[model samples]
Target: MSKPTLTDLNAFKAVAEQRSFRRAADLMGVSRSSLSHTVRTLERRLGTRLLHRTTRSVSLTESGERLLQRLGPLLGELDTLLEEASSHEGKLTGRLRINGSEAAIRLLLQRVVPQFLALHDAVELDLVAEGRLVDIVEQGFDAGVRLREAVPKDMIAIPIGGDLRFLAVASPGYLKGKPILETPGQLALHRCIRQRLPSGKLYRWEFQKHDQEVLADVPGAMTLDSSQLMVEAAADGLGIAYVPESYAHAYLREGKLVTVLEDWCPHIPGLHLYYPNNRHVPPSLRAFIDLLRE
Candidate 1:
């Protein structure tokens, strides 16, 4: 083609982001020489130097500054539109990427995912499930699912799941003869299964009674990063696990585990799907959201 291709804009964006051809090359999965040649080709077509280059640094020229300022967003939006169209098949077929916690995924997938896909049979979903909170914009995710407590104020949050309750539970084997903790203060004396958060801090046990809320830094015999692990540990009668009620459902039904201190645990706002306020709401995302409601 005589005209520039999308690859050209992508190369420009990569170079601009890194300010180094070598770094851009690594990011774009291309050789340094190839990146250099591509930039040279782009400059030739544009008939101006877009970058001021030195041995150790690269910055935009006057012309480059103007172009970069305007080009960056325009190109990004173009890519978004095209990708959305392709992913959604112009709202006829589509694919969606949802970044979220594993627990959140497990909680909603059974009811929401299947119905949403069935309604939009052409829509495909790729779930990025991790406990670590991710920046959806920086990571180029279409949308993110997170608890309302963690969502940023700048994003638009649509509540997808109802109120979630924390349940303090242990195996019948573990709770036998243990003094029941009727208050939040007493949890400190118990051997609780703890969750190590991404911030390198253990999750503070949270409790609510009537209109009052409490966050307790409890001592633990064992701490794990994953909720699944904590549940397994609790099932083995290792310690009392303060976990989401959803995770304890099966055990609660089978009498393997029993919930304790029900009155102390309060209902908290649940999961929500969030997206950048500045970003165009893609049809695919809308379709997926509707599925969550169903």
Candidate 2:
């Protein structure tokens, strides 16, 4: 049997890691059928079945599991060395995948992304924006961006921007006759646009002023997941919305939405870009982080 080519081995690893030909092909920028053929050719050369495939599932055979156990670390080391060599030559070339909330990603596009891309022309930065938080390492992302408080304790997190505050605001039409909301407790008297968290739980609005802090399960007639949508709903006079101030800034400036509990909302640690602390940082990711720090 001929030796397996590095490309074939890597292709197989991608399929094994993702457990779906479609996902692996998407990540590798190849057709699923082509990727399947490549993995099959590798298995044929090795004279052992690497995967068990069914209509809806894929699983590694014993031989495939053993090969992956040994190959994962070796390929990681190889990637690190390659990145280091490229960096030493004053060129950073690799793909950096980042998982983040839509709001966090919007901030990056506004401030950091343009500068980073200009400096590292060879690097491919893949930004995946979603409402849900994901396990960056397990999902094969190079890093993740989220609110600083949401980052896992085990990860190395660096703040992406200055502090942020969540403001409780409503359209002027909606608040015209409602009594002034002096405290978070008064939210009970108003209809709030409830925020549904990624984990399928309703978000309890948090407030802090001086030494007092409160978490209120604010009453609502409508629930939404995205902050942008929440702001839009508030602007439409659906109800009061508690969202990041940035999301509602345009409406606030246009005299559509007005802050209700300004004193209750306090600045908190803002969005952060985080990566696994135990792994070697890829050169592309390191460069991006350095740019953020600047």
Highest TM-score: give the candidate number: 2
The alpha-carbon root-mean-square deviation between model 1 and the true structure, to one decimal in Å, is 4.9
Clashes of 1: 5
Model 2: how far is 251 from its true place, Å?
A: 1.1
lDDT of 2 by residue, 188-267 (tens): 99999999998999999999999999999999989998889999999999999999988999999999999988999999
For residue 121, give model 2's deviation from the true position in Å. 1.1
lDDT of each: 0.81, 0.91
Q: After superposition, how far is residue 77 of candidate 1 from its true place, in Å?
A: 2.0
Model 1: per-residue Cα lDDT over 1-294, one tens digit each: 256667876787678767888878975679988887888788888888888889899887888778777776786577567766676444445457788998778766876887777777766677878888987775557789899999989999989768899899899998888878788788777898889998788899888888788898877878998767787889899998988888888988999888888999888889998988987877778777776666
Pairs of colliding residues, candidate 2: none
Backbone atom clashes (below 3 Å) for every candidate: 5, 0
RMSD of each: 4.9, 1.9
Worst 10 residues of 2 by lDDT: 131-140
